[model samples]
Target: MSDALLDIRGLTAGYGDVPVLTDIALTVGAGEIVALVGSNGAGKTTLLRAVSRIIKASGSLRFLGEDVLPLTPEALFARGLVQVPEGRQLFGRMTVAENLMMGAYRRRDRAGIDASLAQTFDLFPVLAERRAQTAGSLSGGEQQMCAIGRALMAAPKLLMIDEMSLGLAPIVVDRLLDVLVAIRGQGVPILMVEQDVFAALAVADRGYVLEHGRIVKAATAETLKSDPALQKAYLGSDS
Candidate 1:
């Protein structure tokens, strides 16, 4: 945990006066893809909301070794902590390029921003092809790609993706997993909350199993993939 780029200890958060996540402890270390897997209401999204400062969380939170518990959402964004929300929240009326550019609103480096844009387009070629197209007009998979591309536009140090495979075909999910690995190769660690447990384990170096808002299991990806209880719980098969 000493090398963790993002660390959370004793984190608890939820909607107004309603507790959801309880005493959550999670970490994403450098050059690693750490998966958080659980059922729909297991506080997966709530934890992300807390980390991004969209919801208040009480805990010892640190990012890049700096205590970030008091930082505002805007400050967190500027610090290279980015999240790709669960629904692929794209600005429907805006062009693909425009939406991506919005990720760099806080940045003043014109050259770096342009370079990052080119990098994003290269990563998701479909986005480049539809650079001028309105986000609302894209297919579901394309929209997801656009959402991720927009996050990469920010040049994030740590990328947290919620439900990257939601509503996409298995093939599309595989492609995005490949992208996550590629992103990791580029030195950006990822903390992903995935609906597809197998897909998440396949690419992640490690995984944390969340049950009823608490971490029940944490292990290497292969260990988790072969865990009997998890196999039956999520995959519905032990074979």
Candidate 2:
């Protein structure tokens, strides 16, 4: 068996009685960057919600070899299955440092939290430059960094990010993607649901293509990037 850190099988979830995701199965192995590519309304965010327990879902969901279907969102997060939602949902009024400190709320070890915060600042020096600044006052990219830094402070084993490059400039996106690679090098697997197929596949080790709430393709990043049909369908390129 592969060393899968987060595994989902036969997952079907939706709002109330309506199903948006159907028989979805995917896995994020240790130290892998796995991207999920799809169009709008394809249930990418819905799948994240289901996995995080923000919404109800059926079937098996495992993390670090533990069955997570029975855990509440808070419990799952404490167990190191953390999510950095789309829109970089920071506590707007809170200072960058305060917002980051929130990520370690479940932890009791003071020294470890301090080390994580220091590591986060070291990774994103711009955040260190703005630690006391209000999160709402930062630029779009800086806010995204803070949001990601906050997740890092939680010491996540698996980081699930939605629309990571959304509404950001190309340079900023590149910077964020680099950080993701570095994080993966440090043995944190990422399950990224990204709107930018090119950007996501560029750094991902593997990718899953979802269309209309169902995964239509799953392969290595190179395979997905090289597929002409996938390019036509998602990138709208006739060539």
Candidate 3:
């Protein structure tokens, strides 16, 4: 079996005629956590959407060695390429449990789905505690957890999370990233897009720096942490 879970080559995508991603190429190996970091308007979200096939794109997108560019979002989900999108797009009117159950809507294995729900609760006890509460009633951090748990219900092989640390307290973000690390330990590769560069790099095994829709640097987390250019551009200072 190949170690590369997801691969992209010469990816070019955008909205309408305006291109956002230009000649982008990257890879996520099985069980690896790869972070995509960049400043605002750097096309980080567009890249994830392109990989998820949510928008029209031109590229070689492969998952598990099979071409994925031809697949739709639903098809991609069926193949375990699940994305926890930015803004935690949960059903506001639905109960937390209901929203979570929706994640397994495509699944037919009742017993297996139940098992996965239990696992999700175990991973996030807060959700279990708030199962009866409407999703919109939860705190910002709690909503984020529900979003991730919902994606997990799909039993994805490659989990793509966008902006995991957005709009949360530092402590909350830390807790969420810890759970993500735990999830990675279960052998699921993660392609994470985060503006919280320090936190993202802390957990990432390798990372790519995207600027103006291009990958300007690819390096291990340790090397990226020390790059002066990255430090000045992303980390706020060259020192």
Candidate 4:
């Protein structure tokens, strides 16, 4: 746990008076993909928001050996704790290239930012082709790709993506999964919040199942895939 790229302990977060997450403990190691899967309204988004400091949270949280509990969202982002938020929240009126450039807004290294942009375009060539087009003009899958490309521009060491497959076609999701594997190969760890339990676990090194904001199960991806209870509830498997 000491070597974890992101670590959380006893984390509780919510909106105003309503509690959504309770005593959550999780870890994402360097160069690993950790999946957080749960039903809708089960506090999956809340957990991500807490880690990104977009919401109030109390408990020990650390990133790369530094405590992040007291850090602001921009501060966390500067430390490579970047979140590709749900809904592919792109600037609708902006060109795809402009949206991607927004990801490096905090960086001072112009050359490194450009290199990251090139890498992003290499990984998502469709984005490069549509660079001058307005972001909102793209299809659902294309929008998702642009959103991911924008995140990659931040040069994140720990990329936390929320709902990578949401509203995407099966083929597009497959392609994104392949891209995620490639990203992990490049040594950037990911902490993903996904609704498609099977797909999330398929690409994950480890997975955690949340029910009512509490972690009900935590196991290796292979073990989780074969779990009878999880299969019945999430994967629609009879056995």
- In Å, residue 72's CA in model 4 sits off its true spot by 1.1
| lDDT per model vs. reference | 0.92, 0.92, 0.91, 0.92
TM-score of each: 0.97, 0.97, 0.96, 0.97
Per-residue C-alpha lDDT of model 4 across residues 115-159, encoded as one tens digit per residue = 999889889999999999999999999999899888998899999
Where model 2 places Cα greater than 4 Å from the true spot, the runs are none
Model 1 poorest 10 in a row by lDDT: 230-239
- Deviating ranges (above 4 Å) for candidate 3: none
* 10 residues in a row with least lDDT, candidate 3: 230-239
lDDT of each residue in 2-51, candidate 3, tens digit only:
45889888999999899999999899997789999999999999999999
Tell me model 2's lDDT, rounded to 2 decimals: 0.92
What is every candidate's alpha-carbon RMSD to the true fold?
Answer: 1.2, 1.1, 1.3, 1.1
